[model samples]
Target: GGDNLKAAIFSAGFKEGCILLPLLGARAEVAFGPAGLGDLYVTSTSPFGRNRTMGEKLGTGKNLEE
Candidate 1:
């Protein structure tokens, strides 16, 4: 050890993995609920993703509906 030094960190910017145990349980409950109705909060990280739709609409100066 150099000068008795210790360095460790866990952060989003550092790309550390987080175990979302609470969120996992909540998501299961939401999926089981009838009102949830398969609305699993989807987003597009691909060309087909609704993200692209939003971006296109934004470029066209049109408001995305839902």
Candidate 2:
């Protein structure tokens, strides 16, 4: 049960990150240029679930503690 819980948490986090990262990158590209996409492809492949979540929240104008 503990392992399942951990897996579920990881899954949810990754899903949210994967969803937000691209959308935000698209917005950046629109506002700036192709470089706005930045290292999206590279970052998305890394095991940075928590980092991605943080980025998503910041990108959406939400507080990190939120």
Candidate 3:
């Protein structure tokens, strides 16, 4: 993915700087997007994040779509 981004930049001759940040305190789908750069990350806000207040939901067998 990093390589892909670099390629997109190099191939396009992009020289300007841009900022990219995961929207904080927002749903991941909304935070990222149709152009989302990275694979799903486990952040503090994610339901499965480390220190998950309710524990990693996946380990508990919760459906991902729920």
Candidate 4:
């Protein structure tokens, strides 16, 4: 899935450097579970959004009580 996304980005003419952070962010989610998702939220282009906030809280051991 990530590989396909990467290929698409490259096909779109984006250089490796431009997409490295995003790929790494995606890898975090695939490799680290919720904690990785949190990291992805912070590291990806979109930061401090609702999903990111939730991921961060969950990564910090917060339960989804609500």
Q: State every prediction's TM-score relative to the real structure.
A: 0.27, 0.38, 0.19, 0.30
Candidates arranged by TM-score, highest first: 2, 4, 1, 3
- Give the per-residue lDDT digits (tens) of candidate 1, residues 23-51: 55544344434323222222222455565
Candidate 1 backbone clash number: 0
Candidate 3 residue lDDT tens string, 1-66: 487875665434321111223223444454344323222233322565444533567668875654
Best candidate, lDDT-wise?
Answer: 2
Instruction: Give the root-mean-square deviation of each candidate in angstroms.
Output: 12.1, 9.4, 11.5, 11.6
In candidate 1, list every pair of residues with a backbone clash: none
For model 4, residues 1-66, the per-residue Cα lDDT tens digits are 597875575444334433564566654224334444344434443566667667778999998984
Regions more than 4 Å wrong, model 3: 14-66
lDDT of each: 0.39, 0.55, 0.41, 0.53
What digit string (tens of lDDT, one per residue) describes model 2 on residues 1-66? Answer: 487876676566555555675677644233233332223333444556556667878899999679
Off by over 4 Å in 2: 26-66
Candidate 4, which segments miss by more than 4 Å at Cα? 1-43
Error of 3 at 66 (Å): 57
